[model samples]
Target: MSLRMATDADVPAIAALMRASVRAIFPRFYDAEQTAGAEIHIAHLDRAMVDDGTYYVHEDGGEVVACGGWSRRARLYTGSGDRDDDARLLDPATEPARVRAMFVRGDHTRRGLGRAILEASERAAGAEGFTRLVLMATLPGVPLYTAFGFAEVRRVDVTLPDGIVLAGVEMERPVTAGRTRCPPGRP
Candidate 1:
């Protein structure tokens, strides 16, 4: 029941956790294909790790039971709708960050790990010198973001590389000094 940074050895378990989180969180809001593709996001995580991005995992008895991560320099993509200037990455005037993705295994749900992950992400981002954090919220992730002080900036359609499309929301939170609000966005 302690959280630590993710190591390369944790990749496979992280992938399984991501898959489980997606399945558990999306049953009420997404089609099978859309929900299924959520797990594929895990494949991109190696780059995040290599970039020195912060990835936290909750381990119990040497096993990763829950996890989350965030990228100080996150990915931005052109998609199916308008973008808020605030949602834009690489803004010179703001120290921006993206909570690219985050998930906890299904069996570990309702035990405070998700909240722990979120707060850890906020701390990591804030400590890394970011003033604001952004994330694309999925149907099941909206409430969690809101609970972490992330306000909805806009809802848009994202076109994945494989031409898969999904409805998602852009949310932002101003990282105040000394506050750890939620898990990683990439979280």
Candidate 2:
């Protein structure tokens, strides 16, 4: 379908798509509690797309089928990438944008929506004067990000507030440096 900036009207469908995406994608790398925790967490984090100012969505027939976002983050932030290289290798003056919270609805899988969201996010980052963009990828999402030229910086097992553990890969792509110049799969 068609990608666009997320608006207030798409919020509910975006939330449902986020939950379904996490519930479906996280299971390949985690267990029942972890999956449930992540699903619940997805439903809880509404403001991520709010004041953050860079939320985006792909809508079809007025329904949000995909969503993702990027925000200005401190280079020292640890949630989105491999800690060893990402945290240690980053300088706030250098990499100013981090892409987070990407979700594609379950029914829309394998349709290149993931790739589209990523490229769009990268373009947004570049437009914002950010050269490097970082993201945290669930196990299944790792390959998709990898295929888009995001190099792994680290892997982490994060414990939620409820003590449920979920693992993800941290990756970085240099969108403005001409290093991350891959094309989307297809429309």
Candidate 3:
């Protein structure tokens, strides 16, 4: 498999992959109702992420299998079906870079794809002088972020368009000189 920065042309494939991945993987942690309820709100690909060059996609056999990225912008996650001040530039001196939109193909789980993207984002953000990284972790993404040294700061209840609220965790980890320590055996 190969990992590369995502381009605008990759958005459609990325969105499909995100939806497939979430539908297949989230059921393990969420019920069918909750899974279906939150799918649309959770699976969209924000074109701005690609435009900013902070998003990435993993390819295997010429197929995009996993996708994710980080951002200097203020948006923590996309497709929440709400309006917020997500376009503001973060103060890297005081705020952590936002580690947004991460997903892997369900059949491709347990491999290092997610870890690879996470590390790439951390390195990219660190290169931009961001000393820390933060993201809103879906129930299924918690283990991956935690394995990457992110600690849960709080639980956030996201209300979807139809009023179905899904639980998420806000997580953060410090970045030091373009390096981070992943938990042993996580990848």
For TM-score, the strongest prediction is 3
Of candidate 3, the 10-residue stretch with the lowest lDDT total is 76-85
Model 1 scores a TM of 0.79
lDDT of 2 at 55: 75
For candidate 3, the lDDT comes to 0.87
lDDT of 1 at 7: 80
Per-candidate alpha-carbon RMSD to the true structure: 5.7, 5.2, 1.9
Q: What local distance difference test score does each model get?
A: 0.68, 0.69, 0.87
CA shift of 118, model 2, Å? 1.3
lDDT of 1 by residue, 1-187 (tens): 8988888778888776667777787667878777666555422344454247477889888877787667655364222223445233354247567776566666777787777777777777777678888887776777777877788999987766556677889988887777655546733
The candidate with the higher lDDT, 1 or 3, is 3
TM-score of each: 0.79, 0.80, 0.94
The full ranking of all candidates by lDDT, starting with the best, is 3, 2, 1
lDDT of 3 by residue, 1-187 (tens): 9999998778888989988998999999888878887577788887888989999999999899999989999888865664577888899999999998899999998898998999999899998999989899989999889888899999998777777788899998898676677666755
In model 1, which regions exceed 4 Å deviation? Answer: 41-46, 50-53, 76-93, 180-187
